[model samples]
Target chain A: MQMLRKLSAGLLLLAVASFASTPAAEAAGQTLEIVKKRGHLKCGVSQGLPGFSTPDNRGNWTGIDVDFCKAVAAAIFNDADKVKFTPLSAKERFTAIQSGEVDIIARNTTWSMHRDTALGVDFPVVNYYDGQGFMVRADLGVRSARDLDGATLCTNQGTTTELNAADYFRSNGMQYEIVAFEKADESVAAYNSGRCDAYTTDHSALYAQKLKLSDPKAHIVLPEVISKEPLGPLVRQGDAAWNDLVRWTHYATVAAEEFGVTSKNISEMKSSSNPSIRRLMGQDGSFGDNLGLSKQWAVHIIRAVGNYGEIFERNVGVKTPLGIKRGVNALWTKGGLQYAPPIR
Target chain B: MQVLVLAAVLGAMAWLVGNVQSNLERQNINSGFGFLSERAGFGINQTLIAYTEDDSFGRVLAVGLLNTLLVSALGIFFATLLGFSLGVARLSRNWLISKIAMVYIEIFRNVPLLLQIMFWYFGVLRNLPSPRQAVSIGDAIFMSNRGFVVLWLEASAGAFWYGLAALGLVIGGIWLRRRAANAQITTGQATRVWRPLLGLAVALFGGAALMAGVPFALDVPHLKGFNFRGGLTVIPEFVALLLALSLYTAAFIAEIVRAGINSVSKGQREASAALGLPESVALRLVVIPQALRVIIPPLTSQYLNLTKNSSLAVAIAYPDIVSVLAGTTLSQVGQALEIIFITMMIYLSLSLLTSWAMNRYNQRMAFVGNNT
Candidate 1:
């Protein structure tokens, strides 16, 4: 009896050891397979940034970035609700994705050259065009980002914003002391206390923060686009096929917008003679076979989150309280920077 | 069985750490404390110690260590004062006072400290009026949205003179106490010790003033346009963190103190009373001295706990070691293996040092009580 129990215990321990060792034993091959077998895509997202990944009263998350993750779910499983949202702080998002705690990270992360090459992660597409800017109290009498010389700037730590703010100030031959915090809320409080002379972040975030402030009329974001912050989503490096699927989910949205297919109008536009739209919607043939998806993969994404422009306008763009106009985020046909490659 | 158990645990830990290291290194990630010598080149928000973006990472870690020690040390001092007072009051005869003390402990002990910290920070501290409309304690003091500001004396060389005089007074007090004790023992007459203590205090204070008064000047805080100009600024985040930590830890300390005081035999107070001692003297000269032996060991552990708990300062952005080293530096460098290892080692060393001091304290008290 004792021998049998001991044998079973030894077998259990070996199984556990093998489970733990599998990550490195076959990391590249098993990682992609494990994610597919799990069915639900685990995606890390921002903590309650209204236009990014904020949750509603019922704890159901909805935002532009949240929709991006949902669209990835739609493409993968033909189900929009198959994404599990992991709420992460600014510091934890990238690490969480890298450690395989999340299958992908759909947080409003910026795509930089250093991040592309050094971070060991793949940024799929520049879904949102953003720029670094500063917001200051109108009562402070400071006019532009240049006037922020010698000012104390409250920026969120663990971000490109910190380095960008520094470069912006330094390259402009101006000097400013940085007062960074991990959370956006803490930075807002410090800025609101007049402890800071300016608050710097992506320009859209400035508008969101101002709307939440006690005095909305009291602050104005300066008119300086300092750095090129091409905001996008990312996944862990390796698995070229998985990377393609995640990247093109974002591309599908932009492509749909360019093809004049809004979510409300997509089901009706299905019968059109446009060859590009037919190919994109998988209507012309089984175009998604090589990539391993339903023929209507692009249609599923559009139905899930609408087109790129619709998601933007609903969240942080002109229709929202932030009232930010799409300057560079507009479609390519409309003389903006958003241009996607051919679906076929 | 024990040998097998120990071997298995050790082997597992070694494998886990090795796995993490190999995985990190395989990604072309260089892993070592060698990064400490590299340029930090990143700015911090709320650093007390000297730091610059141009400083080395080792210098930045030192800054974090200093901030952690400062907050924890300050919390220990304040918590002791609050705890001891509440402990005594709970034992008081007055119902109202004891009830109030009981309420204080119960309220603080039950509520989550993080929530309390947030409440104090956002609800109370954030509502403080702007600097120009600051409340003044006196002409020399101001309180506002930023924090309290008091008139500080900028001592010239006289500060050194004052420090020397104060040291002399402490030595003088010791000598006087010894003399008084000798007179009581040998001559069977009590010599007073208060007058000499007073004389030493005044002489030291006066000499420091008359000597070189360390180039003293007070830069009293002034309410400027939208901010305070002149006096030292203590931000609300730090104040809230300290307040929440001290109050939360004090509730636990008060319970420890009460348990210690109750553990002392009633016979101690009875014996002192039979010798015609007054209540205050009986408690202070007899009960307190005995109860302290029971009190200190647990109280030392509470102090250590408070120190560890202060790492939660990351939630409030206080720039403690956890926030700066573990959160910011680890994320920026992505050297989790090295960063977390260094952090754990620092905390372990701190804890071991604390336990060593507590053990020495226990030994001294054991000798003093049992031998008598």
Candidate 2:
């Protein structure tokens, strides 16, 4: 009994000591220093959401989100492969970042006011302009969202998509049932097996997942975009420098596309007469230095992952299996939402 | 010294909580239960109570808890019944029956419970035909990918009074059984209690039910446009989870039962047989009571395991407490600290209550004095 009492006392002291040491640990901007010290960026992505971040049989990560992570690595180390991917579920993604398990979360998470203010995470830029939409069988004769009365919809649980779906049906006075699954694949499988009349998620994900159905030609995606979903890369709060670096890594891709700079012609564009392109390519000014990166960081990003347009078209655009049209995702000059601040 | 140790532990706990609070403040993560009263704004497919998208998070949590308990209770009931049968079958003299029971226990216990649940859900239940091609039973029950629809009784207004009459009959039957047992013990006269008690109960409940124009009516399922129109529709999630949980837990329970029966000595059974008691009566009156002494303790653990393992309902999206409340609600509210702590406390209390009740039964069955 005496030994047991002493053991418990020792445990109590250890607990208190551990608690006393945490405040000093979280101070002094730890994320960037740790990343540089480790020499690799731990980027969190989706478990297997096609066109976002799915791995091939060779264990190589692909898709647009994977490209964004590689671009960040290139800007920091001039080597896109100096990054490791951590596949996470939507329920576990925020906690993963908050706990410092991953440096940045590039998962296709929607930016919302509640998440920004309360979840202790900050979204620096929207990488994908997405919105909630529904996909149903063509034979259902459901032409629009209003035609989905008395329909059973399958979706991934613990997401903004579930709430938006419920609110839409409730406000429209339509009776519907939602069969939510823990993972995106489970929801897709259920939808494919005819357990639900429609499958609802982000418009881009619906397009990507529809290609996996046994009879892909039988389903048609509805045209209505129910909720604004500005998907972006997120980082833990209070790391200003790291957040800025990740933010600019994405913007550099968008800005590259706007300047009509292809990855093949990036080296040749260095001699361009356009002053903005010269400054963006780091031939003039301290644009990269201001963000605590090398002068040619944008050049490294472009060479590593190409521009935003290239990444999208190769992974999910008209020629890919997903074949998603760039509607609102087009450049701002072309009447869309992909805008980047001037490099100057 | 013990008091000092407890005080040190308490001090550590308080300091840790203070550390978390400061960290949360710095990170700007909200730390309160005020989100409980906010609108849930999400739909649940299956709910025991009245719920809508506009319901509060508190109501959603309550609904999730009810669903968790409902599945766990059903799993425990069916697993125990199947386990006791398999346990006896394993000990049967017939070699084929014993081998069949052994094979069942081996197959279920070797595989992980989560895999079993997913196999039943995705591989088996999800492959069923859609509602358009639903398989029906006697034109009253239907099975499809949507759900299993069964004909059920819809009670009328007079059913309430009829239920009261049935309760009274049950109480009278219990009294008659005690009187008959006492009469047989003291006077050596076997009273026909079952016939009289059953007759009285039937007359009371059945007569009142008939006079009230049959207080219950059958609600049959019919084919609708895309699904069944009426009756109680059991969701595929519940069926798959329940089937997996009961089968997996019953395997462990069968082993426990076998060990319990073996713990009872052969001499006790032989003695009962020498006393001219029939084989069935001797096994029930002598062997079972002794076997129960060993069974009740471990049996409590299996029950608790079933309850906690029900948390795996999330994998198949059964909307249990962990899936709906701690999972979806926690992500929506971003109050993981409070939500996880509350879920842990709820499960702890449930296990404690179950063990407490089982311990009482164990004490009743314990030997009166130290004889061995």
Candidate 3:
């Protein structure tokens, strides 16, 4: 008994000591300096959501969210390939960021008040303007979400889409059942196997997941967009410098699209007389210095990922399998919500 | 020395908690159980009690707890029944029966429980036909990918009086049983107890039904817009989780039981036979009762394992405590510390309760010594 007591006490002290050291390590907020020294940006993304972050056959990732991480990498290291992707589930994404497992979460997470305030993470920019929508079988004849009364819907758990569906059903005085799964693939499989009447998620995700269905052409996305889902990248709160770096990297892409700067023509447009272009290209001011980056940061971003429009059109545009239109994701000048502060 | 050790442990715990609180405050994340009252604006697939999107997070946890208990209870009941049968069958003299039991025990015990759950869920249950072309039985029960729906009874106002009448008949039957036992002991008369009790129960129930008009209406299930509208809808998740948990735990339980029976001395069986007791009676009244002393201890562990293993219900989305409270609610609330601590405490309490109940039974079956 004496030996057992001594051993247990020793074990307790060791556990307490180890746990005491972790909070101090996690409390260090110099994420940018750590990323710089580590030589790579650790990015958390969805396990497999097409047009957001899905791995290709060659193990290379291709999506709008993937490009955003690459854009941040390009701004910091001038090399977009200096990023390691950690695929995470919906329930694991925020914890991954808070636990310092990843520098940023570009997993197409919605920017909600509760998440922004309580999750200890900050949504720096809205990379994609999405909304919760439903997709049902074409033979079901459900043309709109309003017609989905008494329907059983399948969705990914721990997502804003689940809460949005609940609110929509309740406010509309409709009776419905929701079957939520941990992984996106499981929810989609459940929906495809006819366990649910419809599958609901962000509109872009619905279009992306539809292609994975056994008979894609048999499904129809409803016209109703129920809740606004401003999807974006997340960084740990209290790291203002890292937050600014990520926020500006996304704005640089939007500004590049507004200035008609393509990766192919970036070299020729460097000497252009446009002041905004000059400043964005790092030829005019100390804009990058304030963000703790090099002067050619935006140039590296443009050259690496070729602006917001290029990334979108390449990954999920009209020519791609997702074929999502640049509706609200288009620039403000083009009657959309994509706006950026002046580089000066 | 023990008090000094306890003080050191408590000091370490206090310091650790203080460190966590400081870290949470620094990160600006609120930490408390106060969020339990917040509106859970989410939907659960299966709930034993009434739940809605407007309910509080506390209500969601309650619903999840009830679901976990429901599956664990049903799993324990079925596993015990199947395990005892398999245990006896494994000791059977017949070659085919014993081999079949051996093969079953070997196969189920070797595989991981999570994979078995997924196999039953995705491979078997999800492959059922859709609601549009549901396989129906008698136009009242429906089997679809949505679930297995069976006609259920809805009680009316007359159910109360009929229930009281049945309760009175049960009490009267118990009284008659005591009187019959007294007569057997004192007068050596073998009075028939069961036949009269059964006859009285039937007559009383029949009269109650005649006056109360059966007190129940059958609620039939029919295809609605998306799925079945009525009846007792047993979701596929529950069935798959229950089936996998029961079968997997029953395999280990069968082994424990068989070993227990084998441990009984051969003299005990032979001695009963020498007294001219029939083989079945000797096994039940003598051998089996002694075997239980060996069985109860390890069998308690199997029960606890099944209860804890029910957490794998998260894999198949059964809306058990782990799936709804720990998986979904923890993600939404982001209170990993508080939620995980509570979940651990729940599982610990459940295991301890199971151990306590089994210990009580073991005490009752323990051999009592009499010294003269």
Winner by TM-score: 2
> Residue-wise lDDT of candidate 1 within A120-227, one digit each (tens)?
578888878899899998987888777777666787877778777866776787666676678988889778866577889998778878877779899999999898
Q: Considering summed lDDT, which 10 consecutive residues are worst modelled in model 2 chain B? A: B363-372
Off by over 4 Å in 1: A1-19, A29-32, A117-119, A147-155, A165-181, A186-198, A264-275, A283-287, B27-30, B155-213, B223-226, B370-372
For this target, which candidate reaches the highest lDDT against the unseen true structure? 3
Better of 2 and 3 by lDDT: 3
Clashes per model (N, Cα, C within 3 A)? 6, 0, 0
Q: A95, model 3: CA deviation in Å?
A: 1.7
Q: Write the per-residue lDDT of candidate 2 for residues B32-97, one digit (tens) a residue.
A: 889889999999988999999889999998999999999999999999999999998899999999
The regions of model 3 sitting more than 4 angstroms off are: A1-15, B165-192, B203-213, B368-372
TM-score of each model, paired residue for residue: 0.88, 0.96, 0.95
> Candidate 1 residues B88-159, lDDT tens each?
888989999999999999999899988988888777886776666778887777777566777777666657
Ranking by TM-score: 2, 3, 1
Ranked candidates, highest lDDT first: 3, 2, 1
Provide the TM-score of the second chain in candidate 3.
0.93
TM of chain B, each: 0.89, 0.95, 0.93
